[model samples]
Target: MAPGEPAEPETAVVIATSGSTGAPKGVLLSARALTASAEATHARLGGPGQWLLATPAHYIGGLQVLVRSMLAGTTPVFLTGTGFRPDDFAAAAAQLTGGPRYTALVPTQLVRLLDDGGAGLAAARTFDAIVLGAAATTPALRERAAEAGVRIVPAYGMSETASGCVYDGVPLDGVHVDLADGRIRIAGAVLAHGYRLRPDLTADAFADGWFTTSDRGIRHDDGRIEVLGRADDMINTGGVKVSANAIERVLCAQPGVRDACVVGVADPEWGEAVVALVVPAGEPGDLRAAVRAELGPASTPKRIEFGAELPLRGPGKIDRAAVKTRLQPGSHG
Candidate 1:
C-alpha cells in the first residue's frame, strides 16, 4: 500500500501485534473503530486533553495516544533523547500545552517512574489519568502509585480492539465484556475488522459479535472483570493445576522481591514442575515458606532463580519461553 492510497475497505490501518514468538499478526482496524475507542476513552476520563507519547508509535498503546490527542484537538508531546527515565518524562510532560493531561504506559515504565523516589511520581500525578496497558499490574504497584498521589487506571485490550476498551476492569461505554468457557470475550464498536491476511485465524477468534481472547478471566457480579493469566500458562504439577499469576502475586508481595515470573517446566515424575524467576530488591530471603503457606506445596515453586532483570518481549510482557529455558534442568541462562 502506497502513501495516500486506499487501504482495504474494512481497514483504515493494520497494526501488527508484538507476539512473544513466531510471526506477528496484523490487526485490521477500521477508522470507525479506532475513533470510537478514542471517543470512549474521553468519555470515561471526563475529557481528553494533552497527551504524552512515551511509548513507541508502532504499538497499539502508543498509537492510541495519537488518536486520542487528535480527537481532543491537542498536540501531544513526545518523549525522546533517551530511554524511559524520570527526568526525561518530567521534561516532556512540562511541554504539554493543553488541559487535563494524559498519557499511556506499560507497567514496566510505570515501575521505572516510581523507582526514582518522587520526581517521576510527582510528574505522573500531573496527568488526569495514566492509562496502564500492555500487561497486568500488581496491587503493590497500584498502592505505591496511589500513595504517591498518582492516578493509575489499569486498561485491558489489544490491537484487535484498537486500544484499551476496558478501564479498571470495567468495560468502556458501548463495549461488552463477558466470559466464554472461562476465557474472556469482548464486543464493541472498538473491535477491529479482523486480522489481516489470516481469515482462518480471524474466523476462529471472532464469532457471534464477540472476539474471544486467549486470556482467562472472571466476570464479577457488578460487571467488573478480573484477568487471570493466559490459559496456557496454568501450571499443572502432580495432577494439581496452579495459577501462575496467583503465585506471581504472592512472590511479588514477598519482602525483598521486586518482580517475578513463574513458569512450568517439564518434569519426569510430576509431568510439569512449577518454577520462578524473581528480581530481588535487596538481600533476598527464602520465598518457599510464603508460597507454601499461601497456596500449598503443590503450587510452590520447585526451583527459584533470582535475576537482576527479567527477559522481556512484546511491550514489557515477561518472556515466559525464555524464563522456562532458564529454569530447565542443567540450563544456565
Candidate 2:
C-alpha cells in the first residue's frame, strides 16, 4: 500500500518502524485503535483543533496529525518540501484560521525552529501545544523552548501503540503503562493489532495484552514515567554500565552543539567504548568534564566526532545504528 493509504478491512493504518537499531517492522493498527489515540490526544490538549503537518506524512508522528485533523473535521495545513524551514513553518502557522492550533515535531526540528530567531519564536508561540516525539528530548532543549514561549509536550510511544500513548511521562486516558524487569510496557485501546506479515516478531513484542518496548524507564511516585535510553543502547565500558541517552543529554546542554548521539563501539580493552557524534562541529570543550560532572568519568565518551549534521532515518530521528556504521574502524562517511 502507498503512503497514507488506509489499511485493509479492520486495519486502519500501517506504519513502518524506523529500524534505527534493528530490522524495520510494519505495525498494523485498527480503526478503533487509531481513533482512540487521536481522541485521547485531542481531549488531553483541550479538544480538537486545526493541526499543522510539519513532519513527514509517512511516519507515525506526522500521519497522526492528519488522522487527528480528520477526526476533528478540520483540514490540516501541510508544510510542503523535502526540507523543513522556519520560514515554511511560520507560513503554515499563519494559514491556520480556526480554533486552537497544534502540531507535532521531533526534537531536531524544535532545535532548528528555536535557532531561527524572531520568525521561529513568533510561529512557535502560536501553537496551542506541540507534541515532541520520535526520540528522547533533552531537558536543556525543553527549557529553551519553554523560555521562548513554546509549550512542548514530550511524547513517548511507538508504531505498535498507534502513536504517542504517553504525553509528558503520563499515560493518556485508557492507556495503561507498567514497568517489568526495567522495561516499559503499554496496553490500551490505542494498541496496534500486530505486526504485518511478522507473527514471530509480533508475538515477541506483544504478549499477555501488553506491548513490550525496548526502552528502560522508571515510574515516579507521582505516577509519571521517566524513560532512560534503550536497553540495547546501553554502553558497557571497562565494566561500567552507562546510559547513552544520559551522556547525550549532557552533551546537548553545551553551547554550539545542536544535537548529539552516543553509542558503544567494539573495544578489546574496555569491552565496549562509549563514543559520541555531535552535529555542527562544536568545540569539544570539556565534554568529558560535563559528563563527569553529570554522571562520572566512566560515562565520558572515549572519542567525540563532529559532523555537519547527524544521520537521520525519517521524521528527524537520529539514526544511531547508521552513525555507528559510519564510525566503524576503517569506514568513511
Candidate 3:
C-alpha cells in the first residue's frame, strides 16, 4: 500500500503487528470492531475527554488514542519527536484544555518519566487516566507512578484486538477472556476480522469465536487475569521450565538494576542455560541468591552480563533476539 492511501472497503484501519516475536502481520479491523473497542474503553474510563499522543502514530496504542479522540469529538495533543523526552511530554500534556484528560504509553516511557522527576512528574499527574500497554508494567514502576499521583491503567491486548480489551486484568464490557490450555484466549466484539492476506495464519490464531494468544496466563479466583509470559519465552534448563518474564520482574525490582532481559542460550551441560543481560553496568548483587530464593536453583540464571542499555525494538520492548545474538561467543568483534 502506498503512503496516505485509503484502506480497503469495509476496513476501518490496518495496523501492522510489532513482529517482535516473529514476522509482522497486517491486521484488518472493521469499523464496528474499532468503535466497539473505543466505546468500551470510554465507558470504563468514565467517558473520554482529551487525549495526549506520546507514542508513535504507527503503533496500535497511539493510533487508538487518535481514534478515541475523534469519537469523543476532541483534538489530541501530539508530542513531536523521534525520541520521548519528559520535557516534550510535559509541554504536550499542558495543551490539554479540559477535564478527564487521558493518554496511552508503554512501560518504558513511564520509567523514563519517573526518572526525570520534575516537570515530567507534574505533567503525568495531570492525566485523568493513562493507559499503559504494549509491554508489561513492573510492580515497582507502578508503585512509583502511583506515588507521583499518576493514574495508570495497565492494559493487555494486541493489534489483533483493535487495541486494549482488558484493562488492569479486567475484561471490558462485551469482552470475554478465558484460559485454554494455559494460554490466554479472547472473544468479543472488539476482535479484528483477520490478518490481511494471511488466511492460514488467521485460521491458526483465531477459531471457534476465540482469538488464541501466544501468551500464557492464569485467571485468579477474584476474576482478574494474570499474564505469566509468552509461551515461547519459556526456558528449559536440565528439564526444568522457567519463565523469562518471571525472572526479569525480580531482577528489575532489585537495587542498581535499571532494566534486565533474560534469555536461554545453548549449553552443552544444561541443554539450555538461563542468561541475563542487565543494564547500567553495575555489580549484579546476589542475583543468583535472589532467583534461587524466589524460583529455586533450577530457574536461576547461569550467567549475568552487564551492558549500558538493553537493546529495544519497537515501542520500548526489550529485543530478546537481538540480546541473545549479541551474547553469542563469536558475534562480538
Worst 10 contiguous positions by lDDT, candidate 3: 1-10
Clash pairs, model 1 backbone: none
Question: What's the TM-score of each model vs. the native?
Answer: 0.95, 0.94, 0.95
lDDT of 2 by residue, 244-289 (tens): 8888888988877778899888888999989988884346577778
Off by over 4 Å in 3: 1-9, 280-284
lDDT of each: 0.88, 0.86, 0.87
Q: How many residue pairs clash in each candidate?
A: 0, 0, 0
Instruction: List runs of model 1 lying over 4 Å from the truth.
Output: 1-7
Which residue pairs in candidate 3 have backbone atoms (N, alpha carbon, C) closer than 3 angstroms, thus clashing? none
Deviation (Å) of 129 in candidate 3: 0.7
Q: In model 2, how many backbone clashes occur?
A: 0
Candidate 2, pairs of clashing residues: none
Residue range 8-120, candidate 3, lDDT tens digits: 56887788888887887889889888888989999999997899989887888888888899899999999986698899998998888976899999888898888889898
